[model samples]
Target: MADIKVIIPAYNEVDSIAHVVNELPKSVSEVIVVNNNSSDNTVKNAETAGATVITELRKGYGYACLKGLEYIASKSKQPDIIVFIDGDYSDYPEELDNVVAPILEDDIDFVVGARRKNLREEGSMTPQQVFGNWLATFLMRLFFGAKFTDLGPFRAIKYDKLKELNMEDKTYGWTVEMQLKILKKKMTYTEVPVRYKRRIGISKVSGTVKGSIFAGIKILGWIFKYSIK
Candidate 1:
């Protein structure tokens, strides 16, 4: 079994997927890219980069992630750790080591790569993104008593424990769902600061006003839904 397997969920990210895949640490045994019905050449690019590609006809982030998990579960030798990263190249691929190191050392079951706001490129995030992150994280801390900053896509978690969470968010709530489930399970979790940069393409969420509002509602709703349970 591989020590670590990185899974990237991509939708129309042909421009950035190859770079993200190629830059990953060689220590990572395999790179899996979930092509979420992208119209572009995302799969071809990922394949060209020597990444294992899986096509998920679904059009949502959660769907892509679920498909990736299913692929991993069917592997002959399951990886000890699974890392989730965005295919847009917004996150620093080099920092993947930091996210998985804690798990390999048995320090935590989940590790979130929190983007250092000051280090992120200017305009890389919209106002709604900034406020949504702050508000949602604050609510989680107040209600669920979990500490987290930006719920960016870059994260790592143990494979077995992740399955126990039974994640089911189908949209932008994916990140919050994972975090809330881990907290509810009382699993060890930690956050490490990571660098963020501008993505090659525009974001699907937080790029427009309507998308941000909907995302915020879904995230907050999930937090409260899981907390009251």
Candidate 2:
């Protein structure tokens, strides 16, 4: 069996961090939670749940993710695969196996868990999220010739290939950055249908009208930025 490590980037997620950590599968060899300047007990709660907690004082999703990657790289024996899951508990931890199964068994490099829209609870996603997904996917297909649905957070990838992607988006652009980079690299990737639900706290991006506009601009800008380069 390939060694698996789960990386969760958390920020002020005290309410859901512990539950998310506890629900992860035992098949995972290690869980690394990067506390991104959280003002709550997120770090303590995650540590209590058996995760190896790391501190990323810099406040950004990319900062936390890069910190986790650094931690994984420092391991004497690096993990064969690394799974990125949100610490917000909006995603189902039980479905992790399905997300990584393709990569593990078939030599696939990446797997994205596409949330089924119908399965999502009411108010779990705002109207802007639905439209944004449509617009972004459409733009990616039109510009980059890449097809995708639901840029959901629950995803898995081979460790070496992730390093090759050289991800560096600092804020809301992180998810789209990964997608665009993987496309540009021509890596093998697939999407699996996964369940979604409302999160314990409000979303930082799509929860507010202003956040939604900024995120939309960033996502579209990245797609076009890479397309023109």
- Native-referenced Cα lDDT, model 2: 0.89
The positional error of residue 157 in candidate 2, measured at the CA in angstroms, is 0.5
Clashes of each: 0, 0
lDDT of 2 by residue, 34-138 (tens): 999999999999999999999999887888999999998887998889999999888899889999999988999989899877868887778999898888888
Local accuracy of candidate 1 as per-residue lDDT tens digits, 1-229: 3489988999999999999999998889999999999999999999999999999997889999999999988879888888999999999898898888788776689999988777789987777888888998998899888888879899999988898999888888999999988888899999888888888898888887778888989999998897788
Local distance difference test values of all predictions, in order: 0.90, 0.89
Q: How big is the RMSD of model 2?
A: 1.1
TM-score of 2: 0.96
Locate the minimum summed-lDDT window of 10 residues in model 1.
Answer: 98-107
